[model samples]
Target: MALRTYDEYIESLKAMRPNIYKFDELIEDVTTHPATRNTVVGHGHSFKLSSEPEYKDIFTTTSHLTDEPISRYLSVIQNREDMWANSRLKRRMFQLSGTCTGGRCVGWTSLNSMYATTYDIDQELGTDYHQRLRAWLKDAQRRDITIAGALTDPKGDRTKTPSQQDDPDMNLRIIERRKDGIVVRGAKVMICGVAAANEIFILPGSAYREADKDYALSFVIPRDIENLTIVETRHPSDKREHEEGFDIPVSEGGITQAYLFFEDVFIPNERVFMAGEYKFTKQAVFNFISAYRAAIGGCVAGQGDIKIGAAMLVARANGLHTKVFKDKIIQMQINNETTFGIGIAAAALGKEHPSGTWLCDMTLANVNKVHVATLPYETSRLAQDIAGGIGETGCMPSWKDFQSSRYGHLIEKYLKASSSAESRTRAARLVEWLTIGAGVPGCMHGGGSPDGAKLMIRAFGDLESKVEIARRLAGISEEIPEPGGR
Candidate 1:
């Protein structure tokens, strides 16, 4: 089977039912709709890249299931090598797209995480979920579809669990289990990249108690499946998506989030990987973050790469040499590599799961997650610091205004720096867009919150042994405790 080209991909999305909406208006064609088109176009770049000889390896891989040349987006991370490839692919995607290409990144991780989880489920519960997943994956590879992974649930109150909530639908739940399939109801909010996807991969939002079994659900369904309504979430860049200006550096690239309401959606048994398996919910979530958090280092680093380039361009636009901000640029480079190196370390140090999937080192991956949450902002700050006020602030005239008859010439003439008016303004706009616009990704909480990663750090780390090692090195054999504890 052949992989999808960029045009074929767009046509496929166009053929889907109109279930996605933005600004209370139905998006008939995602490829042309202002709200969704940019993201779709951004993701489509990978389709073109997959055909190129140099990038073919980065974007295309043989599916282990069928041994067919498929999109790397469809490849499973079977070993440390595959995991490293996945990380590099993510960084390259961000480098080219200049934004989050969640259509494949998260969904790829979701499938891989489920690969391990379903194996455990089948071993203990004697279910055929692993087989079901294999069948679905085989078909998915054949189609070369774009999948957006959905994991976050809008829990109404923090203190209450899913079962304790007055609204049981606070977390997505299985409303009923028919012989042929299951019925699901509830919303997955703030899900990234649904606007650019052909399908949605659903995973349990979090660990759940047996009493909350209804909420312990996972499945895959067409994005436009009946009873599914997608509403693109709001962002500071919403207006900029439609703006006629240098505000959006790349008109074909942007990022999106959505609220997916599954109003009693029916997913066939073959597509259901986990249903009412509350005991394995924690395992499923663990499997997910292990990969998601680690690779996110690449995501931020890619954007940081762009930030550095834009900042330098702005400096030259102002007639300043690169040496003027050498220290700042060096600091930005350090920030990018820190998170990136930590992620690669996690991948290299990982152990293979029983399911033949490579799981990242929990301690190092969480450590990267913490860096992902904090370092990108400092990088952004340095880029802005180097770009000057015009590049950092969205205060310049719009592209339309810059072309207006009345004051266009005056505006253009004053906007000129050491570079031409157009070049100077364009560089400024790019820096602004990257640092503060849609180019900014969910660094602090893309996969999960940093606090959650810290908790995992505590769980996976050997702190007691570290303390013992410290005691021996200090030549203090007796137990020396903290102020209040032994």
Candidate 2:
């Protein structure tokens, strides 16, 4: 079968009838629920883009396995060009949506990470996990399924490893190992788009020691599988979606995240990609981080574009588009381009792993993420500065209020700026959503925190080369210690 259309994608989700709960109430239909419907719409847009002629090259790619056109989200990154293409595709999707991509691209990164790791494990241990994953990838491509990448575990204690924790269920673990399959029991927090996704791809969030074998597991399962529950997380201004108005500008096509609970969920052997291979968990995580961070840099830069554009629009509407505001806009552009350029560099510098999957340059990828962690906030600050008090004000007159006979003329007269009252209001709302609402926190910690990126940067940097350069420049002798001498 060919790639599914937008309507087909929606129907496919409706057919799943995932076990989702929001605000302590069971959502009967996620396709129509206010909290999750927008996420489905956001993901549906990607499917639409794949079928358009203009976006065909960016959003669709030929599958190496089936030799058929498949969503780029399911394509393997075979070379540096593919890596660069992944970043460009993510940026284009973000720019079009003006918000998150609803976690549609996560499965692609997970596939690439798992593909490389499984192959390496097989080469070392003579396991057949690589072939198993390849078969699944082919089917996923043919079906064009949306997959949610679940990585973060709800750690009960920050200082303790999974096995060290007093509560064994704090981190996702294999509670029972049967001959036919394994039963996993735990919870994953902040799982983006899980309620709308067709499948969930699980990966270890941290490296595990030998003793933490049960926690060092990875697998995939249907989102609607039994013994699983999804609890949606509330974001700032989320309730605005249920309200009647043009007041909630960003909610038009928003995103959703949730907590995923696995209550002894059964995973057949075919779905189990990694189990008890503790040493490979670290490599799997690093691969995912490199791909995820590079993609995020591009996505965040695209969002920065929207923020800068909105800031300029707001400044113009308020008659504040002067030299000061123009300079601030330029600063925002600089930060955005810096992040976008690093993502491109990381992709261009990618190297092919022995498993034939491409991996981005780790140092540059981490650098890209670190910049994204702070630059978006800086962009938002400049935007709010130009927007004045309007950006900070949360409450605005509803659409009904503007249309009322008693307040229509009053609002029209007072709310008017350099532009129409409606346009000005929309610009302010957009800036508010991009800056203070949902956007900032997502940028700060979406892939990983800035501190985590710094650690990876330190781990991957060429410190020895820098020391040698300094020694040669300063005419200092290089001291070498004898192997046996302390």
Candidate 3:
């Protein structure tokens, strides 16, 4: 079967025994553990969506290679419409989950990037990397497997190149190339959804020169492979999961980050898509980021929808849903719509690559990312302003306290405002979750930090044209170009 049911996906995850750690303790069953179970459930929603009639068109697509129906998460973008559908699917998934859906989108992004870059590499150097990747992707589609994309390396010294570093292993590299395969040793930090994935796709996070050839590699490996360890990173309010009667609204659908270590892990020759192709490193990374950042614009705007809804709820509960607060809500809508508009523009303006995969417009994608880095914060600030004192009051009384026979009446009396105490308390919890807990920081640096988007904007934007326009307007030059021309 090309597509798997939700139950089948969960069962597949249960069959593989991965090495995972949380707080120095081994997680015997990631699918059942509190720290990871929600993420798996969130991921499973994608499978469910694909099977449903309403979402089938967006979530399932025909595989170009095999001519079978496969999840869109595993299919390559074949045209501009596919790109637009991809962004809309991401936004819908985020709105449904109320958090990032682990790493499914990351896998989709990396697959398209590899398809485009490897085709170029093979055409130029007469290599078979594209064919190898195509074979692997077809198998992955048939199995409907979840693949986590690992991009960031644990660079020990930011100022030093991989070769210049005192410890060469700090950046993942080929320590030994055997006849059948290669041995890789190093670590990747800020990895998303490794514990729940069936496999991981590794790519160089930054561009590299010839001297960094060893570090400029890309490949795929199974999560349960030997010599690989995954440690889940701790986040703020993570302990709330263990506390009874502490209903965290935002975290109901959990997300994850981890540190992945590969110590002399052997990757078979067939799985090695790119090995020592340093010159193509930049293209691979840029291709991935351009698409991923556009996705961020859509998903983050979905999150902005959540923030705006919470703000409106709080204002109504506080008996302050007047023109002033209504205007704030409108402003939040403006920011949210702006980001979503950019994402659609990026997708609509995408161009096809030689490899038959569509690539997003770089300038618009960077602009989308830059807006994502800043607009969400302002949305959160407006949410807090509308939330008023309740936003700063911290978490509400525990469910236990609200249920206690002795204190229940007192809480019900004091907490009640323009509405029931339960409504106000839950609204406050949601605001806290979106503003200070996980939502704000995630928006500010999810795809990449704001400064990173700024650098990309500078690189992709055409400043020379703007200068020419200014000079021509001032009659400094006789020539004036046509509209939309340089």
Candidate 4:
């Protein structure tokens, strides 16, 4: 079947009844809830783009599994074109939401990584995980299902492995192995986009030793799984949503981050793609996250574009468009475009995995994430700076107040710069949304934390080769002895 249209996708979400909680109460309907409905609209934008004639090529693709058209989020990268297409689709998704598009990018990256990593594991251990996963992907593509990626562990202690955790529940584990499937217990913290997803894929977050066998569990759980409960994350701005309701200053498009609780949730045997395969866990996590980090460079750069534009608009309205202010605008643009360039460069340098999927260059991918970790934060800082003190002082004025004679003249007299009072207010609102609302944290840690990016740099640094080059250049290289012919 071809991919579902935007309307059809929304209908599917409306049909599912998820057991989700936010703020101390159960969310009755995801489509109407203030905190989650906006995110659903953000996801709808992705489906809308896929159907639009201008975006069809980038957002939709012919599935390798079914040969039918599917969302690019469901397409596996098998060639250079596919790699570029994946990067483009993710950027569009991020721009639509102005935040994370949930778990689409992570799941997309994991598809290729799991295929390649499992192939190597199967070759060494006679396992058939690669085949099982391919079968599942075919089903997912045909059905157009949204799969949430569960990669981060609760990580109860900084210095301990999963096996050494004080509480086993701190690590997701296989509590029972039945003839039908494996039953898992434990929870995943900071899982992205749980409110909007139809299913979840749990993958190991760290390398597993033989002693951590039960910790090496991987499978898919339907959002409606009997024992699963989702507690949506509370952001600092969430209170504003509660106070102001739907018109929460920020855009109607945002993402929902949540913690997932799996209380003895069961996965059918067909869905249990990885079980007690400790050796493959590390490769699975690394391969997936590295590719995802490269994709983040594109998504974060797109969000930066929106933030930078908002700041510039506020600057112009405040009559702060002097050379110094314009120069700051130029700096914002440079920060954004630099991050975007790394994404394209990594895609250009991609190599084929053993399974034939294109793998982005690891070094360039890590470099892209490092920039993502720092540049957006710096850009947001400059944006808040240029926005002046009004961002902090501006009071919420109703449309009635703007139109009334009591305060209309006063607002027009004080708020106007290059435009009317309404325009300046809108600009200020946009700036507030990016600089202090839902956008900044995603910029800082969406791909990974800045420190996580630095860790990758140290882990992947090839300093030994640099040392050898330095020795040779300094005329201190030792000659290697050659074996004499017999």
Best candidate, lDDT-wise?
A: 1
How high is each candidate's TM-score?
A: 0.97, 0.96, 0.94, 0.92
Off by more than 4 A, model 3:
241-252, 322-324, 393-395, 477-486
Tens digits of per-residue lDDT, candidate 4, 83-140, equal 7676677777767677777656566666677777778878899987888888888988
Q: What do the candidate models score in CA lDDT, each in turn? A: 0.88, 0.83, 0.82, 0.76
Off by over 4 Å in 2: 241-244, 247-249, 322-324, 478-486
Could you tell me how far off, in angstroms, the CA of residue 69 lies in candidate 4 after the best superposition? Answer: 1.0
Off by over 4 Å in 1: 241-249, 480-486
- Give candidate 4's error at residue 249 in angstroms: 8.8
* Cα lDDT over the full model 4: 0.76
| Residue pairs that clash (backbone atoms under 3 angstroms), model 3 | none
Worst 10 residues of 1 by lDDT: 240-249
TM-score of 2: 0.96
Tens-place lDDT digits, model 2, residues 1-486:
659988888888889855999889998888898878777777777888887899899888999898999998888898877877787887786776666764677777888899999998899888888998999989888889999897749988989999999999999999999998899999998877776689988888888899999988888888899999989999776655443555344554566778988999999999999989999999999999888888787788888888888888887888764566778888998998988889888988889998889899999999999999889889989988888777764656766777889888899788889998888878887888778775665687788789999999988997767878888889989664447873
lDDT of each residue in 336-452, candidate 1, tens digit only: 999888888999999989998889999999999999999889988998899888876567777887888999999888988899888888877877877887767689888988999
